[model samples]
Target: MSASAGSPGGAARSLRSLRDLYDQAVELPAEERERFVAALESAGSSHCAQLRRLLAAADPSAESPLDDDPWARVEEEEGPEPVPERIGPYRILSE
Candidate 1:
């Protein structure tokens, strides 16, 4: 489930306290991100979903927000731009 999908599961809601810490850590140099993640994981960050959520929020490019149903309640978030198209190796062509 997504924030956009209104997922307020315990795991999602429970991570809010750690948000500020995560926000600070995520601002580490991009090259340091992996080490930071690894350190966190090694330091008993065992909850996979929670970790993924933090990492995903930290780096939006790490994953796609909506992989299906482009018309599924995204109107308020992104306006009415058409679903974007991938261009060449690394670009999106959108309205």
Candidate 2:
């Protein structure tokens, strides 16, 4: 039997489905996204409103976090670390 929305499993499944839908929606071109959401709404999808809100909040022009090198800032702020001449008992000869 299918789990009811009130059940924990059902809630988890609903969330996963919504997340998948949001991912799919975000991949569509901006011009086509409205029609994608409209189709969902016309079909009486439970996720229609939440999906719309997600799409509305998305900034297509914003740079993705992955596009930046996080280490670049650390290097700029702290500079490069000096190579160690020796460890506790061993000498660092190379690199």
Point to the candidate with the largest lDDT: 2
The digit string of per-residue lDDT tens for model 2 on 30-54 reads: 9888899899889888999999888
TM-score of each: 0.38, 0.59
| Runs of candidate 2 exceeding 4 Å displacement | 61-95
- Candidate 1 to truth, TM: 0.38
lDDT of 1 by residue, 3-93 (tens): 5324566556556646654675677877776677678678776543465567666675665656557675687677787654765685675
Checking candidate 2 for backbone clashes, the offending pairs are none
lDDT for position 27 in model 1? 78
Model 1 superposed RMSD (Cα): 16.5
* lDDT of model 1, residue 33: 61
